[model samples]
Target: MISSPDDLLRLAPDAKSLEAGRRLFYSRRWRLVGGDGQWLWGEWVYGSGQRATESAVHLTAGHFVCNCRARERPCAHGLALVLMLKNDQERISVGQPPSWVRSVQYQADRQAKPKPLKDAEAADERQGERLALMGAGVEELELRLLDFARRGIADTLAQGPEPFLAAATHLADAKLPGPAGLLRRLARLGRDGTEADIARTLGDLYLFVRAWKNRRTLPPDRHAELLQFAGVNIRKEELLARPGLEDHWLVLGTAEGQEDRLRFRRTWLRGEKSRRFALVLDYAFGEMPFERSWPLAASFQGKAYYYPGSYPQRALLPSTTPGGRPYDGLVGYPSFVELRANYQKALAVNPWLYAYPVYLSAVTPTLASGQAGLADANGEVLPLHPEYDNFFSLLAISGGGTLAVFAEFDGYRLLPLSVVTEFGLVKG
Candidate 1:
């Protein structure tokens, strides 16, 4: 028989581990109906009104597995079952993970890869389209930006050390219409540009793009700090040392666009517990921002490392979609039928699914399926799972809250959308 509750508590004193287990337990309580030693199993009711059986697995390694949608190392249901087992020492027959678990796991592993999501490509395409929309003369410049973007993307996909320098050099001193025009011109530089030139241009470009996209979402100081990355390298360690912003910062949304002669990425960050304070990490071709995001949020009571060093720890409310695009700003929300029709029309025109899944902030609120939605600092509605919901593109939503889509860049490195946006370059 199991000892007291304190015994179980003593077994896992690591606060982060305990918190993770607790969070997992509460997140999906449905699967854990009850257990018996011979064959620990329970029925999991789904939104579709279907009941699926999931076996409780207690492994020799002390690992737990529950057959559910979450692919975490120890899924929420599994943790719940473990907690139950720990307290109720009755020897129960916990069966192997069910067939569905194997099936779901197989599907997840099949789709897992280091490829950029569809939105990355969609962002590239959208940048092209946006440039074309800016003016007719910008076409030639757009072609150039596209070239640079291709190379930079390639470098990112391979996880190369620093590919931005090569891509950035191609854009220096190029002139075009607005910010997007500049990026298009830069892209035309090809491999002939210098590394130093690329770094400087990228540095400045990151700040501009990030500031524009997230102007409404961040507080004044954070906005200023992100904007500063355009001309300076804000060390990650420096940001970590600063005070009053440590918690799980959720990845809200990603946007890609281009400024003149530069490509950009903007990754939005919102604190799940702290609220109020938000961050935008802007990345450009040559310069890289320090990785201060983790320390900036997780430090509390002078003790750093508040978050666990495990998967599926940090997350926040999903993002809502932005209101109407440039000319469509005045249009009312599209009806479901209309939206579906438009989505279908989009597919017919561009039949191939996005190289990577395109993620959008929800234009409307929805809880169905795997989509996530939350309001941006500016109060804009961002959609979380448009690619999965509308395009039927296979994807894997990670426990770390990163949305992974498969697309290859010619040479560009994977950059956070916030970094790209900060530079006022094209956002993808």
Candidate 2:
């Protein structure tokens, strides 16, 4: 009663997933694959030690529920189940839906509840209580991460995003909001992100937990970075007391977005004399304006104090004076080769680094089938940010000729922010 194999293949996220589903249909590790008049259900087997997972699809609503680590919708298991119903109904055991199928059917309701914590102990602890709690929280997180790996990828799919999200309360108690945010991100991915997305986050959490356990061995600055990311806040006076860098800072670009009722803004700047990059982050409640204002492509004489870190970048400008553009030309990496090398060096010092601002020279804009990117002289292409919607405007500025671009690089993709061509500055 469901769609044909051709129609079912369309449900797969990509060709690889469709191929995988077809292979599962033929190789056949499926157990108890069955269908009731309104629903299709089956059991999928992983290798020897891994447990078999149950998957189901509602015929009328066309809903797919699966317990595999695969990130795609109607994953191999779901698609193969449909194929089984369509091709080999005799092999399927038709009957009333079992208890397991009925219980996990409404996946949204199957959240893993958070365990309780002893608030009295937390209240009594003193001196290094914060660190102690964080250490304990990190340990608990390590257990969950291990469980995720030991149980295999299908574990979360079988349970739902709740198991991953369950760590939030414990992390909040430990004052490790950053790690908690990462867990939330992982849970979201467990629900919707691809295998690659989930894997990257798992690796990040593992490294972060190990880093916390061995925090003492890290450099003093690196340790501060860890604390900074772990939701640690320092007094403004203390930060200003540290030596600040004074330079002619040029605003490269700024990006702003909103989530829920909170709006956020990030402005990036580069110093002409020091060639140093600085990021200023600000958050405002609904309809509120940001604290700092640095318009794009503007230059000013200012002193910026940076937060303590191995690769110090986020900075606060306490004061500024209107200034003209520098007499010297804008400096940038000659090619992607040097740019990547320097970026890797920065990442080596700060693995938790998010966006590394960069200036590149001698590149051309490229657009193919709705995708946009920049190409260097040697034909090396760095993709523009996936969310970028200013391709045509950027192309107009370049005029099919080479130009200099300022952007943010996040290890994998580049978010082109502004371009300086013969016509002047064009913010993307």
Candidate 3:
């Protein structure tokens, strides 16, 4: 099955493409022309009169081929086709594949076949060139930061967003997308942001630049993190070579977000025996479905491969143990104090980490001091993030009583992800 609409939105190449696809869906421009058991076909008509171009989309074997001239893979026409199938499956009817659809499927199948490997020496040479380009980008970024400091942050802000945007674009062109993305976010800091927020953003950027420069001096684990933040791709082969840990991992909660063309699904897990936390990330591109999604509030015995880092959170599940049983109970910090201590410990290893899993054994939701928050047994309260929208639902579930809840702490506030209720786990 294809991903949900929210997932599709996240996988969209960019805001413009997503908006265009949404418009197509709303406008009913896509007609489900035909389908077989293995393939679905759609015809899309854009514009009116002579300006209209009839485009066709062929979906098969988790891939889409479209006759649109658009450079984007699974272009707007294809996305519209997917949306139509998802929303109006009854409109589609089974039929034989057209000649053009068969041709497209053949081409896709041929492309899917494995190709001969490239020479190791040539691959190494290409890698070296990439590293050199990234190094040059880092140096340019350092110079830009120096200039910003010399000119004063206030003055730089007064000049508007062009300078920062231009510098970020330069970094992106040089293949430093991680830093480029950070810079782009920094550039968009609005007037509503506090002075502390601006200062913290600048500090984080400065630290990242310094870490990239002095990476060699750091420990191996820290160095791995630095490389990751600098847009360096870690090969899956390398990660798989590391040792694996087998345990009963409880799925605490899940969250999803988008970064440009990529969609990220983060599943938080806790090892019942090891009492360790791990984050499993699944990514998709342009409406592609995630590899898999973990069942919430269930335990699965699996061998997890940990990425090399001081505080290893990201993991890969290569395989799962057969006949695994669900975990009967949840385990976590009993109070906000213990949760805060764990959060601080994680940050000591990875300063850039903004979110961590936290579980409160018993906390009652309350509206106090003009904010929604939870109060532990000791009467100490921790505020919830302002963006949390399930307060009333949580209140109703708990009946204003204390309940166990899994949440994400973003340095300042907690955002509830799920709560353990008599009925089962309710996700926020």
Alpha-carbon RMSD, each predicted model = 20.7, 19.4, 8.8
Residue lDDT tens for model 3, 1-428: 43454444455556787677767767655554667766767666666723333344444334556645565655676566566667867767888877777887788776666545765678688888998898899889889888988987788788887887898899989888878877776677734444565567767778888887787799999988777777777767778898988888888899877867788888998887777778898877765556665778777888788888899888887777532665654665777788788788889999767668888889999998678998898898888876688898988988878999998897778889889887777796
Number of backbone collisions per candidate: 107, 0, 0
Stretches of candidate 1 exceeding 4 Å from the true structure: 1-43, 46-58, 66-72, 89-97, 101-416, 420-428
lDDT of 3: 0.75
TM-score of each: 0.23, 0.66, 0.71
Task: For residues 19-58, write the lDDT of model 2, one tens digit per residue.
Answer: 7777888856777777777777888777792778778887
Error of 3 at 188 (Å): 4.4
- Give the worst 10-residue stretch by lDDT in candidate 1: 305-314
